[model samples]
Target chain A: MEPVSEVSGRAIPFGRKNIDTDIIIPAHWLKTISREGLGRGAFQALREDPANIFDQEEFKGAPILIAGDNFGCGSSREHAAWALLDMGIKAVIAPSFSDIFSGNAFKNGILTVVLPQEQVDRLLEVARTDPINIDLTTQTVTTPFQDRFAFEIDPFRKHCLLNGLDEVGLTLSRDEAIAGYETMQAAQMPWFAKGTGLAA
Target chain B: MASRPRTLYEKIWDAHVVEDRDDGTSILYIDRHLVHEVTSPQAFEALRLSGRKVRRPELTLAVPDHNLPTTPRLDSAGHRLPIADPESAQQLAALERNAPEFGIRYISATDAQQGIVHVVGPEQAFSLPGATIVCGDSHTACHGGIGALAFGIGTSEVEHVLATQTLLLKQSKTMEIVVDGDLTPGVTPKDLILHIIGVIGTAGGTGHVIEYRGKVFEEMSIEGRLTVCNMSIEGGARAGLIAPDEKTFAYLKGRPYAPKGSDWDEALAWWKTLHSDKGATFDKSVRINAADIQPTVTWGTSPEDVVPIGGVVPAPESFSDPSKQDAARASLDYMGLEPGQKLAEVEVQNIFIGSCTNSRIEDLRAAAAVLKGRKKANNVKWAIVVPGSGLVKRQAEEEGLDKIFIEAGLEWREPGCSACLGMNPDKVPAGERCVSTSNRNFVGRQGPGSRTHLVSPAMAAAAAVTGHLTDVRELME
Candidate 1:
């Protein structure tokens, strides 16, 4: 994971709600077993439509995506987050995200920006003309036309993403606490200390 | 100050509250954690990296399903397809490697009990009433059929549960969806849920925990309840639950995770009380007549764009909203179906009766009964049934259900999430239409440009026999 301080990129706005993980990366893509080349398959069906946002020239190489409410709603395919990352999408602005998808995005260094629907609509409009700017430190999304909106994130998730930390990182950060708990548990439940026996 | 009376949700929630934070969320102690090969790899890796042992090995279980091959075949190394999906294989291997390392019980691919985590969990009684079960799969809500508060978690959360046996969460508002009265004949639980999705639309239950109540749900078998709860995610719910009753206790009594001997009596007594009080209030309530439900099949890319069997596909002009009209037109065009055409007249190239949604033994039996002596349509390229678990497969085979399917020209294969999505080789070709027993009918869900009509197993079987989307009730007549 890497901290995304500030990012400037093209905007690909998908104006649909409940864009599930199955649509992002179809289950067929799961057969290969490797995360490599997933971006090519990302939005495969969407790309089939010549008028799709992903196929539009303006959105090509877009490192940021603006989506509608309840984005990434289906299967917990971490590949959805991975594919978005591989497609060079560093930030996603949406009204809300599925909890599992949001967690996957945060862990993979993808910044999921939660904005009000009005702000998202405004950003989608601004994205038509100029590159969008997302500042993690300021907690705001700014456009060249001088429009800006602040977004909210879970404080703990914000901390982790800002520090490029994952769950493993969070757990490691509490090494002393875990070690202390282990020692205390060993004393309180002696069976746990016996390495090879059942606890109860 | 007035003390608030606790609802069932509140009681179970309070019992599991291990820690409360300033942010107004609680860390809930998970009573049981079920894992599958697909999502457990990364969690195991995280545990290994941290050098932490599983807190309660006895409380955890694992199985492999999503990527297992429906047909038993040898890979280049002579290993099975369970070891085929390199990623899934790696995950399965990691689970096998880590389970013993962590002293957790894991059912490998070859194990007769190994299958979809949801299917295996209930069969093994790991998903008991009044328990807070967490799995790394969205359909973990399937366990909620027995009055358990089960929900899906991410890999990190999976590791959290494995290491600490607790989940950090904010409380969700409860929504009661009551379907009262007797379901009309031929209106199965699958149809009832599909109709619910149609009425409420996909995003209606967003951010809510839904509890299905009333006569219809109460009378449903444990399997039927599971089918309904399994699709909770499809309706945008965090999870779906039904209160525990005699049926629930009967289902768990002799299973692996149920309490033994004297403990069983105490467990049943506790489980019986795991229900809402008479005056329990909910944030929202919606009631629907069970008799109004009919055999439902999706007509468009989304599950909400569905109509009852024999109903006509809606035209764009039928929609008042311009945006909705455009979506409707596009979906109809994409599906290669004409607006106003009868749904039963639509041809189906394939018929799939599997996936977590409708792959249980009861589902198979329903389809088998319909296809018993009938031959499949000549134009139907494929009709397949993939059971949810090894146990289901074995049960079906023991009853010669496989022979019935094969005799009817339907393929009987091993248990896995086959054809539900275009995950494996069982996908319908691009531009083909299918009648599926799975949950979703999203664009290209079965394959690229493949239109899917979601239905019950019996409906799918009837469609396969007719080469079109026909009502299964008609076949019975």
Candidate 2:
């Protein structure tokens, strides 16, 4: 994971509410065994029209995306996050995000900023003509016009994005704790692992 | 001091905590991990790159469902047929190789137990009460029906579980969605859940763990409860749970993975304590009258775009929110529907009665009952019934449900999530409408440019016979 601190770039204004994972990357693109090269398939359905915002020259390789409320509202596909990352999206600003999508984005080093609807609307308006800035350190999103909005994020997520912490390695460091729990679990709840055995 | 009365979610979360970090995140142990082909190949590749082995292989089960075709797998001469899609074939081949290489249990696509991960988990008793189950598929919440703490994770988290069997997590707020009155006739669990999502909106349950309670759920069958819990994700919740009871016990008893004899008795004692205590409070609560729910179906792309079968298409202007109004208009355009049109008058070209949401044996029986002695309407171009698993298909055949479906002019196909996501070749053609028993009705969910209307198996069968979104009650009449 690449460490992310401050992202300043042109932001794509895609103000569509309930923009689900299926819309981000349709199910047809999920067949590949490899995760690379998903940017070509990102938002494929909406990009069918040449005038779609994602493919526009002005927003090409935009690092920030300003979207409407309840973005990424369906599906737990990390491919949605990978697709956005592949397309050079470092941060997404929305009024709200689905729980699973927020987690996925965080795991992949993409920042999910949740502002109020009015703040998001203002950003969407400003994003059309100017660059936007996201400062994870200050926990704020700023526009070129001096518009600023503070957003809340989980503190643990903030640390991870800032440090590019590998979660599996972090959890692996707590192996002793996990083994201790297992030992106690075996004593108190033996039946829970009763049928767990080597694969036949 | 007396201990605080914890809700079911809190109890499960507390029990599963391996360590509580200073950052307010807990390392929660996962008891069971279900794997599928599409979301897992990348995770496996990462493990191989990192030289990491699966920490607890016995706790993981892998199967191929998303990209596997539901059509017959063997040729007439008994040789296996090759998957037509190259990308899909590569993914399936990866899972078949990865699972065994990691020492995990692998159910082959040709095996009797192979099915949608959500369906296979509960059927084999691999998902048990008070356990934490994680899967790469969103509908993994289906196992919550039997009182397990189950939710979906992304590929990164899948790798986390495979390496350590723990997830770094914050506790979700608890919400109780209680339904009291008896559901009206022909209003199945699917209808109830669709109506619930409609009331709550798609984001209503965000950041909350919902526990279904009251008279309605208590009397519901295990399969019915599973169907309701299955759509928790569509309603914006990570998981949905129902307290374990006699029906839950009965559903798991003597299954292949369930505990035996002394273990069963001991497990039952602990399971009986899985429910919330009297006076236990939740962060939020909703009361719904079961009778208010009708045979519901989605009228637009989003799951929250649902309307009762008796209702008419709603105008975009009818929505209170401006953004919703815009979305409604776009949905109407994509769905090729007009405002004020009768929902039942809209014809469908395809009818799909299978998914992790509604392909269990009970679902098959419900559809078969509706299709018995009735021919599919001539206008319906393709009607198919794909069972959830080979075992489910065998069970349906033993019950003569397959014959009933075949005689009704619907193709009886093999299993593996056919047409649910249109990843396989069983897609509803572009620009056509399908009444699907699957969970999502998102844009092009069945296929690019395809329109989907989510409904129950009975309602899907009703639409198949009538060639329109008719209420299942009318067919029963």
Candidate 3:
């Protein structure tokens, strides 16, 4: 996960709420066991529209996506995040996101920035004209029009993103504590040390 | 601080606390780890890179479902699409490679018990009452029907569950959605859930764990309760749960993964206590009338945009919220239906009678009873039934349900998440409409430009014969 100090990219805005994973990547695409070539099937239906943001020349390779409230709802398909990442979406600015999708995005190194509806509306407007800036160090989203908004992130996620820490990183961060607990539990609960894998 | 007796949520919350931060969040230990093909690959790779052993591998279980193809086929290159897509194959392969390394049980596509994780978990009784269950799949909430505080987690959480058997969670408030009275004939569990989602709206239950309590839910079979809890996400609830009762205990008994002999007696004693107290306080309460709920169907984009089978589409002007009005208008236009058009009058080109939500044995039997001796409508382009699990497929075939589907001109296929996402080879083509027994009906959810009307299995069978969105109650009469 990249600590996005600042990002300036064209925005592909979707003005719909509760845009689910099914729409992001259809279940048919899930048939392929590989993550490779998934970007081709990303937004399969939306790409059918001649004026779709993905197909439009102006938004091609844009690193930012402005979505409405409750974005990335539905099945916890990591492919949805993978597809967006594959599409070069570095940051997703939305009013809100599904908790699972947001976590998936955060783990995959995509910045999911939550702003108030008003800020999202303003950003959506400015995005149509020029690029937008998101500074992770300052936790502020800025546009050329002087529109700036601050957002809050879970400190652990912030730390992880800043250090590019996956699950292993988070666990290793607490290795000493875990080892200590294991040693303590071994004395208190000897069954835990049996290595027989019995249910507690 | 005031003294208060701990609720089940609090008890579980306190029991699993590993790290408490100043920010009012505590890391809770994960008790059980359930994994699938789609999300385990990267986690395994991370473990490999960091020289980490699978911690407490005994608690972990793995299965492959999402990427497996219902139809066996060979690729153009003649390598054979083992599970349909190369990506799904890679995911399954990665899981296969990692399971042995980690000492976890792996149920492959060829495994007799290979099916959706949610279905497989409950069928095997691996998800017990009062346990915390985490899976890579969102429908993990289905296990909550067993009174477990189950919810979906990400790959990172999957890793967390594997490494530490714990998760960091902000506890959710509890809400009781009580549906009174018995369901009328032809009204199935799917109808009850659709009615709940329709009444509560999609966002009504956001940030809460819903306890579905009522005569209707109590009377429902274990499989039926599973169906209701399965779509909790559709209603925006973090999870839906039902207290364990005799029905739950009976269902869990004799399952392959369930406790055996003397252990079963002890387990039952513990399970019987997994219920909310008589005076249990909830953050919110909603009472619904079961009699008022009809065989409902979704007409618009979201699952909440539903009306009775005989009802008409709501006019955009009827919505006071401008954005909602715009959404309703867009949905109607995209669906090619006019305001006030009878929902039943809407034609359906396809009928899909399977999904994780309604593909169980009971669902198949219900649809089969409706489709018995009936041919699908000549214009109905596609009508298929995909069982939820290989077990269900086998059970249905043993009962000759597959023959009924085939004789009815509906294709009977293997089990997986088939038409539920336009995944696999089953999909409603562009510009087509379908009556699906699946959960969501988001625009293009079934296929590109393919409109979906969510209904019960029997209802889908009825529509398959009529080639329009019709109620099965009339046929039952």
Q: Score the docking of each candidate (DockQ).
A: 0.28, 0.71, 0.35
For model 3 the interface RMSD, in Å, equals 4.0
Model 1: residue B283 alpha-carbon error in angstroms: 1.7
Better structure of 1 and 3 per DockQ: 3
Which of the two, 1 or 2, has more lDDT?
2
The value of fnat for model 1 is 0.20
* Candidate 2, B100-138: lDDT as tens digits: 899988888888998888889999998899999999988
- Best-fitting candidate, scored by lDDT: 2
Model 1 agreement with the true structure over A83-170: per-residue lDDT tens digits: 8887888888998887668877887788899888888888888888778999888888898888988877777766767787655444
Better of 2 and 3 by TM-score: 2
User: Mind giving the per-residue lDDT tens digits that candidate 3 earns over B274-317?
Assistant: 66666678897999989988898988989989898989999999
Q: What is candidate 3's fraction of native contacts? A: 0.35
Off by over 4 Å in 1: A4-7, A31-37, A49-52, A55-61, A136-138, A163-200, B1-3, B73-94
Give me the candidate number with maximum DockQ.
2
How big is the positional error of residue B173 in model 1, measured in Å on the Cα after superposition?
Answer: 1.7
